[model samples]
Target: MFLQITGYMTLIGLTLYLGLRPVSGRYFVDMATYYNYFQNYSLGAHVTSSKDVVFHYFMKFSSHFMTAHGFFLLMDIIYIYPLYLFSKKYFKQYWYYSFLVLIVSFSFYSYGTNGIRNGAATSLFVLGLCFPENKIKTGICFITAALFHKSLTLPIGAYLLTLMYNNPKTYLIAWLAAIPVSLVAGSVFVSLFSSLGFDDRLAGYLTGQGNLDVPVYTGFRWDFIFYSSFAVFAGWYFIIKKGFHDTFYFKILNIYLICNAFWILVIRAPFSNRFAYLSWFLMGIVIMYPILKQPLFKNHQLFISKIITVYFLFTFLMYFVYYN
Candidate 1:
């Protein structure tokens, strides 16, 4: 009991420290975007889109009693809650290990700093995933998440796809379909969304006209596919061979596959990294839970834990190194 309290306190304290730190050097542009938006919001600038309007007003409301940093700090803190709830409910005995996974994934600090809105929404999506049986609540969380950041709509769609198709073939199909989708349907895809009233700013971002790094349909990126493919195969192992097909584990694996598929399909879209996080945020669980379930790795689990710890320690260090 004492240990648990200490553990949670340590986690919370560390998260708070990271959250309160100034924006890292690497995310200067992302920070600028948020700062600009917040400033505009405070000045009552007209936010054109529903999503931007919503975020703007929320920030405006928050800035009344607190500084902008305070709002960011709050988002950073709130982001961890869903992760905590996930561990408490699903991981149970292995919750500590799960938390370690999350830390190493850089999901918290990276997203907290670079994509505050998405980070907060992803946290809620994770909490919603904790209740796979509660479809209505999960749907609410998913939709709410997308409203916060448009990229999340893909994950929500992916989740819906998982519900319809539970077979292995869908995974293969998603991967294969990405090639044609990105190559041929790229412009059509953008046009379709534009027709559906995707915000002009978002469209600009998608086309790399809004200071975004990558343009839509910028041809295939082997690097993303290489790394992401590993996650897809890992999901396959857990879902099929590990016999988690009917469990929440399968649900996570399914979500990962579908999100990865979307990421692959739109590998060149501006802000495409969002799709990666949609799945990667939950990857700690998809990877950790199965290994914990296996008996042979029980003793070595301690070694595995240490390795994961070291990896994240390296990650934390790299955040400063790369950013600096």
Candidate 2:
């Protein structure tokens, strides 16, 4: 798995270096400015009033673009390695789990290279997963994440839910009831943002109200939905077969899916792609534990796994090729 991960990293690095000029050429002036802001924030310059200030402080002290990327890259390493350890705690031959981590890391690295809050927030979220049993520690981690990006506050509730429930049916019913309430609140929040004179840049970005067209690869792709559905079914089957009554992870997955689904209904715009990222991230974990434990899938699983892997890789590569 290490070798496989290394190979993927090498290919990605080589692709970026070779394609840098073309990639940069394709980005619009505003997008380019954001990239410069990311690189510049690493040099102590304030870019925005948003919560990225916390990350800005760390990046500024680093004092170089390579240093900043290197820091986050190291954090990514730290965040993902523990996932392997966690999987190994349950399944001894945990090497295969590394592929799951690589898929997530590479996909995020590809789309989120704009160096905003998304990449940093994702790394912190993964790290929070490692400390699931420690609420105080996990809460601190998420609070730091909220400082970098407010969107992260969504999953912090899931961590708390783990402490609240032990039964699957009860948890599912509660979550279903809560979804409508959250949606109403989110709608009210949007109205508040409007009343507060929220910057047009952020509003445009969040609501997809800008001039940018919906890229082909944007939104919930059919292939992704297909694969995620299969993973959900497979995971459900594995848990039932193993007599694993724990509902925490399942509840988390349900929240992620429901949140994304609601965003699709309310937003009705291209930025729905952002919510799709949450879906993929949660589904990756949902798929991982089952694939590790089910002997029935051990032989035929690679066939299906490779398809999803290649689909994401191709989607990300094309996103860069077209949208840069």
For model 1, the superposed segments whose C-alpha errors exceed 4 Å read: 1-6, 23-27, 36-49, 106-108, 176-197, 213-219, 293-300, 306-324
Please write out the lDDT profile of model 2 over residues 53-110, one tens digit for every residue: 6755655554554653454444444334444544444546554454444345334444
> How many clashes (backbone atoms < 3 Å, residues ≥3 apart in a chain or on different chains) does model 2 have?
0
Question: lDDT of model 1 at residue 150?
Answer: 73
Top TM-score hit: 1
Clashes of each: 0, 0
- Candidate 1 lDDT over 1-324, as tens digits, reads 754776598678867875687754454447666776666766666566566455566777776677767777787776777887787787676676777677667455667777678788888788778777788898888777776777777677777776787675466567667767777776666455545666666666555566553324455666556646655666666566656544556667777777777666556666666556777787677667666555434477675676577657755764677434
lDDT of each: 0.68, 0.51
Error of 1 at 130 (Å): 2.3
Give the range of the ten consecutive residues with the poorest summed lDDT in model 2.
Answer: 16-25
Model 2 residue runs over 4 Å out of place are 1-31, 38-48, 64-92, 101-109, 166-206, 210-231, 240-244, 294-324
Worst 10 residues of 1 by lDDT: 210-219
